[model samples]
Target: MLKNVSNQQIINVFKFLEAAWSTTQIRSISYEEKQKKQRTHAQKMIDMFDLPTKKKKFETRKPFDYSGDFGELEPLKDDETMFVYRGLEDKFKEFPQNYSKVTSLEYADGQEKMAHRIWTMQEKFLNICKYGERSEMIIAQKTIQIRNLKEHCQKNKKDTLARVILLEQIQGRKKELKKLRKRDYKRFIWLLKELDLLYRPHPLYVDLNTRRARMRQYLREETCRIIREKINAVYTRLDSEKENFYTEKEKVLSEIRKDLSDHNISAYDVLQNVRKLRQERVVERQNKAPPTPNTYRWIQSDKDRKKAERRERDLHRNALVKKGMQKLAQSEEAS
Candidate 1:
């Protein structure tokens, strides 16, 4: 085969091999990694003119601190939530006692410590011979459980179930306490006092939690703020001008005095007449006292309404007695 092969044929074969190698080499070339592209002119134009796209965030306002309205209020120095049981540990020696001989809570197991706490609560809040089913007793039990669970949660952050249970317990306790308060206020007071708990009742109306409501509140606060600022500014301006105003008043008084002299009237006699007029006006005002407001009628509590009625009755009786005395004095004068 080599003996019969022409130079052209051999050259053609070599050319075909070179072409195959070139094709293989082209196919073997790997793809380059994509790079970040520069922004196009159109994209830049859109960015320059178009509004930014963003999530609509809810607007919230800070509630005004009305605590400052109370001038002499003292802030709590210690944690009020951590209720301290007052009395000697030994004094809790009676019926419904924790029979556990574990003297030190430091060495006691979780269950034993919980039982001891419940026993202490029962000792303080439970009535004579009453078991642990009372609302107060239940609240006390749940409170202890919540405190323990809170401690556990702090130690083991992954205990999500405990946290959920803690929240549910708190909500349930709150509802129970609210019911107890409504059903028997005196009992509620006693329970609160024993537990050293602050009774913060929920608002009568549910908060709408809408933007409109928030905006309305914000506007009302703003209006009040503006009014107060304007009033303060007016008072400040008045104070700055007070001296000049008093000087002008003196000048007017002197002119009035001169006029009185020209009219053959004595200033002393005039002042005495003015004093008598003022006294008579004051007496008339005292006799025509304003009637009592019925604002107390808006109070929903029956006890409060009764008390207000009693007060009004007393006031009416006092007024009648005062009128009778005045009439008797007039009759004596006529005699």
Candidate 2:
């Protein structure tokens, strides 16, 4: 089935799958983080919504015992913290729309697991939506690609900096994500309004016990439609991603070749030259400049002038030379 698929369709399906997966994964996998945050505020929200009021406010003793100091400071209590959690839950009524997948789960290093969980949800979502091959990863799997490039560079005697350029490209994408946030929030807000109209009246949304602002907008039908469209747009990028990989690979390879030329290193001599260049810079930094002559006008004819200039340059060059290389050459006339 994978073989018969046209390249264009493949790109389309991949993008289709990515968008499908990103949204689905983001929505489904996020519950864990939401649950954790809500667990902290469960008492307050239950009280606010006039739901069953069994849960108690988590209480605590004052950290600092004070009479007059700190202007009669109030004790730091768990109810305040609980209310903050309630506030967040209230503010993010459309929690499923705005939050990315629960990046990190409950523990400190659960971020990777959360990402994987998101991907898994996306996979299942694609299966439901009929997007692409069930096995296709939404985010391109780049570890093998990155490692292979590194190994190739090491074997070919290429510069390490040239080999790592693609890795830098991945890290630099955060700026692109920050740019996305600006536009994404507006879209998110629009989605929230839609949800308010449609889902807010649904039993699950209102009874969430947290009063999300969007639930008041009465726009659930529009919210779902807009999100569906956004998912389509994200899916379209899969083809672009493949093309991006091709371009980035070409760029890195071209740069490696240019690095050799830039340093005048033969492939066989690259390592040897790298060592020599560092030694040269160290010596150059240590050495003092030779004093210049008052002028190279000795007996002022072009040939004598040329010879004088060459002699001066060679003397200075030899003074600056490290143990390995030849001095700057003297005048052609001297030869």
Candidate 3:
């Protein structure tokens, strides 16, 4: 029996079994089980849709008080004071010199350092006189916190809680920054420049999670790639054939020149004369003196000049409208 068995025979048997299985009626479930399954699925969908979309409440961390005068503290002068305020001064100078005047930053713990950093960022973004709780200032503070948390998470690796906090801070900062941008674009730009941040806005229409969206993106990318490749191929072909094209063009030109001479159109070549004229015009333009700056030169016929300018403006507007219409038509056709 084993000797008689072949691979094709085995495959045929499997295929027949598969076909039989496909034709066989499915096992019917009880009404209660069916209802229960449907209910569970419906509840899952309902829960998904009912989930709250409210924005997360971000904690507003107070800016560290950097007002306490550390110089007022009477300590031993010179070398001894340097030892007492060694690491603290350099680390928390931005925080309050008082925190350092008391003890070193490493001994005072990371909280002081974090406060100092936030204060530094706030001082940079906010007004010097009054460090108000402006959106830009808050965003700047969050940005520093995010950076510090990110660094800590990277070093620790197992600190998942820190990572979560970092992500929350990032999202909060992003939302605030976006709001700030909408409220005041100039302030937003200034804040970003001050904080050394690059704002990458989210897409308006595309959701990359869906299969359809992903396929559309892939199709667009492939279309662009194909177009670029085809253009390059066409250019390469043209370059290869240009020598022959130029030779033929020269022959046709010579024949045309001969015919023109025979017809007594002109004694000298008209094209040659045109080329000389173009070169002379270019040379004249190059040699022309530039107009003086900060001085208005009065032109003759100012009324005519104003009329001509208005006419040119109208012509330009009409041309732009025509171009825009053509583009709209092209887009409609493509869609």
Candidate 4:
């Protein structure tokens, strides 16, 4: 039963037991001895709790001596300097917590402000020492980074980020291809063939070559055509309705113009008269129109009538089939 129990559950049980034991009185022991036993028990509980250990502090390395051996190496060119600085910025952006450690580093320049920047450059150089140039690990790391960047670009709809990611992916694929070519030419050729076939049909079309597949494809095309035709028909109907509405509106406007013209009124007076007449006609129509019913009783009744008709048709068909079977049986018996 304990095997299935979690460490936390066990710890909790132990805590409850400790609490229960503390509440009980022990008359035989002195106060000091009882206190010492309690302290020992607490220490044991602490050990059993399995609390997190403190992390080891990062040790600062001694500053490099530029005077004796190298006498200060040549300063980086503008482009190189910018590249280095950019790389440092990227590293800090990736791991902001590491920035504090870099700032704490002792430097002779009295510019504690620049220590983080210097630390970034030093860390990059150290990484190069630990992991040689063009290491497989570095390539794998870059591939992972590019993949993440691609996902980020896709989510955020960043065109520039997408382009950069695409470029990186292409370059990474080229490197992999180059390596494959050097290691195994056959595999390299196979990969090239695979890439070529990415958008094109496979050489062996076993599944798609069948008559059924052809028929299915034809059916799919026919279905799409039918749907397109239906959509076009609907659009045509809508267009005709719109044209009819416009024509009717034009006719009404013409009648209004003729009516106004008969009065020999000014254009402004005619417009005002048209508006009044239109409003009066609208009010008259509203008054003449029947009031809407509270419920859709007519629609419900129509549906019930259709259902009854369908049921009658089914009953008639079933009766005719049964009569025909009985007649066939009688003919068989007479024969």
> Highest lDDT, which number?
3
lDDT, candidate 1, 1-335, per-residue tens: 79999999999999999999888785533333222123354356446544333547997743212111111112222211112333444444552334322344544566766676677667766554366448878877777776677668768888889878877876787788899988988877776665555555678998798745755666678789999999999999999999999999999999998999899999899889999999999999999969997876666577787999999999999999999999999999999
Q: Residues 286-307, candidate 4, lDDT per residue (tens digit)?
A: 8896977769898899999999
The superposed Cα distance between candidate 2 and the true structure at residue 209, in angstroms, equals 15
Candidate 2: tens digits of C-alpha lDDT, residues 1-335: 77987899988988999998888784444878888888869667655554544457888844221110122112222222122133365455566732412322332232343344345446555664446432222222222233334445556655667456645633433233334335565533442342221111114444444346433333565578789999888888876698889999999989999998998878778778889999999999889687787685555678887999999999887777843243324444357
* Candidate 2 TM-score, true structure as reference: 0.15
After superposition of all CA atoms, the RMSD between model 4 and the true structure is 35.4
lDDT agreement with native, every candidate: 0.68, 0.50, 0.70, 0.58
Give me the runs in candidate 3 sitting further than 4 Å from their true place.
1-133, 144-167, 180-198, 205-245, 259-335
lDDT of 2: 0.50
Kindly report which residue stretches of model 1 are placed more than 4 angstroms away from their true locations once superposed: 1-113, 126-133, 152-164, 179-200, 204-225, 268-335
| Ten-residue region with minimum lDDT total, candidate 1 | 64-73
Clashes of each: 0, 12, 0, 0
What ranking of all candidate models by TM-score puts the best one first?
1, 3, 4, 2
The candidate that achieves the highest TM-score relative to the unseen native structure: 1
Q: Ranking under lDDT, best-scoring first? A: 3, 1, 4, 2
